[model samples]
Target: MVETVASLSGNESFDVVVIGAGGAGMSAALFAAIDGARVLLVESTEYVGGTTAYSAGTTWIPASMHMASVNRDDSQATAEAFLNRAVGARSSAAMRRAFLDAGPKAVAHIEANSDVKYRARPFHPDYLSELEGSTLCGRALEPLPFDDRKLGRAFALIRAPIPEFTVLGGMMIDRDDIGHLLNMTKSLASFKHAAKLLARHARDRIGSPRGTRLVMGNALIGRLLYSLMQRGVTVLTRTTVEALHTGKRGVEGLTLAQGGERRRVSVTGGVILASGGFNRHAARRADMLPGADAAWCPGAPGHTGNAQDLALAAGARFGEGALSHAFWAPVSVRKRADGTTAVFPHFLMDRGKPGMIVVDASGRRFLNENTSYHLFGIAMQEAHRTRASVPAYLVTDSEGIRKYGLGMVRPGGKGLQPFIDDGYLTQASTLDELAAKLGIDKTGLADSVARMNRYAETGVDPDFQRGTTDYQRANGDANWTGPNPCLGPIAQAPFYAVRLYPGDIGAATGLVTDTNARVLNRDDQPIGGLYACGNDMQSVMGGVYPGPGITLGPGLAFAYLAGRHAAARAASPEAGHADAREETRAQTS
Candidate 1:
């Protein structure tokens, strides 16, 4: 069942070869193939979709067609303002210009030609209080609906990573919807919502049409892949491109591997390396982020940046600061039933706990643990440099566990069993045992407890002055009638301890490229026939998770551009090498 073409000596190679079949790679391959040029897509894993399948599946494409129809209008000027504000000065002028210009067009292209559907709902807000151009809902385009059966074998590759996660019509549910769902308990409409989800699951079970099984990220990519297959794009899964065949000047093609056999494939058109980053590589993580040696990634396990190494071997110079990383949030973890692992999102779990106080290695309270993953991860990183180890503690009392949601095995419940059993949670009749187990000074913890108790009695936190905003207190429990939402005295018998470590959604540092997804050399020159996307490439948000699907949006867009541009050259024999040697040599010299 495996086809191996040993050499491209006399054989006709594909007009385009996309290295990686994630959302970005798939989009690029499909775009190129449908445009009439022969295409080949190589994926490291036996399956296609990458980190995207595990995501919420929302795409942040501002000024998209969906937005325009819903009256969420924006001009080049508005888009520019937003990018400049979010990225500040990290992104180049040319890079910013290319992203803004092509962003909407990318959205339009998928909507018009692809099997995708979208609706406008703009109530989501940016993480930052000061962020602008971050519209709540409409600006973020979500997939309308998808039927799983249409995917066939490809459906097996798609991830059902999140279970028991009820959603409606591709709508991302936040705290508001949770409240609404709860309030509608006896209402007929509530039953309808419940019925739809149940029917969707039931239908998916019986292989009877998957109409109602429409989730977000999977749904979006599912529709995109369906459109791609219809375009005659042959997705060669379980294949890996090991090397980029570059000449003295630019990349020529790629050497592909399938089932332990190697073959040379011509990229006469070009090659796009959207193969992803090295998050799963322990060595890389430890090297990039100190103390990351102990950390684990929540990103897809398939990403190893194989294409990154291949590009460098081909003499591709890396962009300046190419090693910069993002998305390293400190997290608490426990073993799953499968003996694998499950990392709980810290922000979601930490904010709602009662009598819980997060401290640094110095047993000192630092930044709020309730911040977004990236922000908290950064704080943890910065904290590591000063303290003996990662500085973070979640001190919760019995009442807090009973009241606030700790994200245990059950939803909205205290997660005490795992922590206590794993020695991370230390319960002591006296605070000293808890402090000893946590490796903290008992007096320091006692002092912290005293201040917390005073704050609880006075109904106001004086130490950190917590809960200055609704966002901060939104995750706190209302059971404690206090000026402070989550604050309570940890003076109860049996204190608990959990070891804190920095965790990441994935390694954000990746190969640097241009707007067209072309890999850039040290001098900022494009290495023709080479490109990268997804986590393998530096993020467009300058390391910030601007919103949901922030990483995947540009990942799809640039991969589409990379594939098309390469295919254009492949389809036309007259695309003679426009010598950039002089320019490149001069710059390198």
Candidate 2:
């Protein structure tokens, strides 16, 4: 239940207090409440979803119940083998084993107990499908579309979708909807589907603030929020945790500030920090991620590392020396008419499409265009070490733009004047002219284009092997009749280019915790009455972006464990006190 600030008193208490109402925090609260614990979920912003509301809502979990239905040969051992190769020695064996064992149970429990439902993507390959033990399908799970009208007035609490992805200003569309809308002119069946969606959206705008048909991350958050409401969980938005109230036994409660009033809330179970991450925290980024900037990040403004700071102040240790400090992606920026900047993340969008290539400032192709976004970002970082490759360019031909669009420019979009005028996109009739506009070496760009054309004609990228893996081919345009779906000649006139920058999507290094999601000190001793999940917890993949939704999969699984464990401890009088004493002795020794 959503609570008002006036109802809160300085003397309020609960069995468990969860800080941050993102996917992890919300899921933790729901599981705890279902386990018969009095739970309170707090959010810094008025919205509940945080960065998750803006995501694709795909959770990459191997050996999930969703996978079981598809009859894939995925098991804990196979998943462990894949992680060992992909994550290498960066992550602990216990953490990887725990996630593989608990992921399916967490998904099944939530689905059976609440409105949350997920379906397996039949052909979504792991990001590194060439690696052994990586399956071609039945691992990634997408949340089913949800009707937000069920929440009634509470629906407003959910964060809205990004404007660029929506159509007609506020209507949300999923992958299937986009396909239908794109083919509406081709067939009567598609036309009917498009018409029906438009009609519902139009009607929805009349009585509602936004479209009620929610998809992607919004659907996942909506389902979790609705489940929390049904379980009678107390949720307070626009409330920030000021400080953790720690005693000799560890964190006993927290001091929260809401609307200029500070309130003290006591908790016996534990405090779970799931406040997205430190992506937007300037100091944290500067200290941990030296080259990254918050301005380039697309994470929610509330992810300011508040939870990480509070945990650190309470003696929680930070996970150090991961494969990378943060998850990365390439982002393009364009100023909107309202003066605010529109940042577009090129995730499986224009990069994998044919007739396009990302080139460095020297106008040379440095990496495979069909590689995963995370790997692409890493390559950008590597290039920056030797040259000014931070602001690389994604160059494509007129045919590419008309078919796949570039940045915020939609496919077949009319009136390209605004984009050209605003300088979000640049166009040139000749390769030399395009090179001049981009301020790069004309000879290098011309030679690169010639090589790309030769590769396009032969349907092979000998330099980088653009479409060798199932993962690469899956992201490419399947309708093209080229020898390789990801390779096409950029010989069309009026070539275009968009500047790209390496952006940190989320933090990978965070509070180090054990398999039970209990926050641990520098001595590897669990701090009593303290736990973490989401980005607040050090990533289980050890900062490696193995596939889509790797962050959320372990986040949800460990959060489930945290909730169950906290509730069980709260039910026992001696457990919490005894554990604190044991940890204290271990730390001192």
Candidate 3:
């Protein structure tokens, strides 16, 4: 679907020019186009779908009307209360109300406009289950099932999640459903799944592929984009937004680059920059989050805050230390440089997959073993104050090796054992030898080990108190008998260690936006024709991951708002909302 090229002398115009063809951008484009706005979506990659394409592909909305239809107690008031509590008292009053008021409408509009169907996950809770205002269901909603063929030739334009998160996902499965798949392997219904998969493979052999569909985040975007394309939104991949130009009132146009060429477009409606945050930019990371010394982001390489810079140029106010980092489970993988390093989050989240440890510079326990990804990063920040590079250990037993398949690439050999054989990992027959190998006070190591053993025996940690919280205990091993879930102690023989620290998925800091997504400028004025969403701006949830699809949820909402507003402007330029302002300072630092 290539469009004919045309040269522009003064300015190029469209109803909306959306930067970053990821979830939010794509969502906005679809809505804008539907609103009868001439929409143009620009992307840096050869294909659309940003880091979200690498995600499990679910959209989570709590107290959703969809879930309530399935027999749950979800009302608009309850939804507002949940978001208000999630944001606490640190948010713009107008923005918070706007998010609550407009969230459901956004969901409904997208559901009706896109090829995707919305489904409420069976039972997903907002993080912190014990909280008073939390709801057990109806708050989280995800994209329903979809077929990849709907995209027609544009199927390849979409990317699927990495196998780990997407193997069972259909671009729309709820995050909790991931844990369920491991449980569903024997849920009797597996017999039908096996047959369907076999049938699809057989059809592939005959060249009559039909129902081998795209699901989860991919499915969600595929369906959304399918509808968007049908409505005539032009998604320009491998294209970049070079500059944002203002008119008499506010933003009026943008300069774009593609294939070593640049083009300027006039946007009568506006420009929405949802290009995502700069998680991989070390310089930006060091400056925005001074405590986040080490980051192992799982986001797209192109996520370098280009949109944030553009928003800043237009005078958008930023949130308070709206940290832009993700919590990784800490897994060891071979880096592109052929060096071995740990990928946080994935390692810690899936206990059955692999196991690792975390220690301080002196090879001592600094935080609870099983902590929230956000909290763990904070601990890492605190530890970095004493040294240029803090030393930590990931001690594991031989069983941890065989059961979880723990391994990391080394110069000569692979896995942590070589590190033990070499001097990289401290190895010891007794806890004393292991502590000696770690170069710490042996007594302290032995004492730590003994304390851990006691906790494992009773399933109740005394010190730092691991597995004590409702949410923190969710990741604990099932076989453990103590009051804590992930607690079983580290008393096994032939202990192993690997160096580690706080490595986040990405940063959370971004531009301060009203609930309706109208970016407020430094002077507390609306930029008239501009908007920003996704990681390029401050997270709606302020970097605290509450439940599944946190980023996707609000990102999708603001996106819908941006598109709705853009389309409305395209229809009538004077119909803009008047009061989206700069009081969003409490959102980030």
Candidate 4:
């Protein structure tokens, strides 16, 4: 039964105690419970899914069983080669091997044991497909759509999607739904598909707060939560871990605060720290992040690095000094009708669309707009070193706006006046006027547009080589009849632009851990009875965005390893006070 902090009493103990109830924590608890361990999953907030629920719920696991079903070729050796080139020396060889080996096993185990299902994105290329060892497809897996009505009363616990992503007030659409809706005017089949989806959504909203049909990350979390329920796992909401009770035996227990009451809970298997990262922690962000404030961060507010802090206090070491501190993305901010700010991540939506160019304050293109969001954010950061590029501008014409849509503006949407009136989108009759409105160099913008139009006609971007790679081509407008799908003339009247800023999607640097998902101390020795995964542990990619699901893929894999390892250790006869003391002496010496 899902319990509230108020219902939980005095001293409680479990074989495994999970601090966060996100994808990683929930997956870990599910696996541990399935292994015959009493698992207690706790969440600081009323909801379960953290930043994961806000994502697309794709996991990049090479050579997974689902890939074979899609006829995609992948292997661990090829994946390791890709990591060697993409990650370089940022991550250790041992850690990379552990992930590459365990990722497919985790996927297979979950699929066989739970109601959670995933399908391979057969044609999705890696973020850096041109890099050595990167595959054109078969690495990314998306969660299958689920019926949230199965959760019944527990449906309220799943975090809702951002309002901007939904359609027709509250209807959640998957990637296939989006394609069908976008093509509804072209074909009768598509029109029927769109109508059926809308009708179902309408019927669902009659008695539900949101659509009962869940997709993407929401579907992944919902399936996992349902599996946990089936396994009889106890989930305590509105609970926070106050401190870790550690001794020579490593982490023995923890103090929990819930409903204004503090209680101590002992853990035998271990304490798994999956409480996300320090993305929302002000002090920690200032220390580790690139910018001064996390104003544009789209992560959950509960990701205050509590688990990382508790692990550090218990002698876990910080794995810092990576290539980048966090996984980066460029975001566009606007004020909603409710007086709250709406931060929308410009991820694989409009950047690669035809007739658009991302320019700096000087009105000059700096990087390939068709590249991955993480690389685009890195380019923005690099541009900021010499010029004012933090709040860069994405310029496009009226045709571009109508066909591809700018930030927060839907494709083929007719409500441009409202967006312009609210100052979320800027529009002008000419390029010069648009540059003037955006406070950029008008002459430079005019010249840049001329060059871009020439590139559009010739289908060749000599300046930055946009739309040159398979990865870039996959994200571009495929229906364009031009030489390059990503290229289109920006000659239409009434140009538009939106302000963009560097936003961190999640933290990459976290607690140092060994291959077993055990947190290592300052001496690089695993701390007995203590483990970490997800953003709480240092990313195996070493701050590199290899593909779409890089974060969640390894996060879930390591979490599975941690749960199984902890359960086995707890079941072992020798895992007592003497074993803990012996490991403590070895570390100390």
Q: By how many angstroms RMSD does model 4 differ from the true structure?
A: 1.4
Clashing pairs in 2: none
Candidate 1 runs further than 4 Å off: 1-12, 68-76, 131-138, 162-188, 206-214, 247-249, 321-324, 347-356, 361-363, 388-391, 395-404, 412-500, 579-589
Clashes of each: 16, 0, 57, 0
lDDT of 1: 0.63
**Considering summed lDDT, which 10 consecutive residues are worst modelled in model 1?**
163-172
| Cα RMSD to the true fold for all candidates | 4.6, 1.3, 5.5, 1.4
Stretches off by above 4 angstroms in model 3 are 2-12, 69-71, 74-76, 82-86, 163-215, 280-283, 291-295, 321-333, 336-344, 351-357, 386-392, 401-445, 478-483, 491-499, 576-589
The predicted structure with the larger TM-score, 1 or 3, is: 1
TM-score of candidate 3 relative to the true fold: 0.82
Cα misplacement distance, residue 31 of candidate 4 (Å):
1.1
Give the distance in Å from residue 422's predicted Cα in candidate 1 to where it truly belongs: 5.3
On a 0 to 1 TM-score scale, where does candidate 4 land against the true structure?
0.98
TM-score per model over all chains: 0.83, 0.98, 0.82, 0.98
**TM-score of candidate 2 to 2 decimals:** 0.98
| lDDT values, one for every candidate | 0.63, 0.87, 0.63, 0.87
Residue-level lDDT of model 1, residues 61-171, one tens digit each, is 666777766554555676567667766756566765776667678777767777877665554444542466545455566666577677676666554444323343232
Comparison by TM-score, 1 against 4, better one: 4
Please provide, for model 4 over 408-527, each residue's C-alpha lDDT reduced to its tens digit, 9 standing for 90 to 100.
998884888889998889999998999999999998889889999999999999999999998999899889999999988899898899999988888899899999898888878778
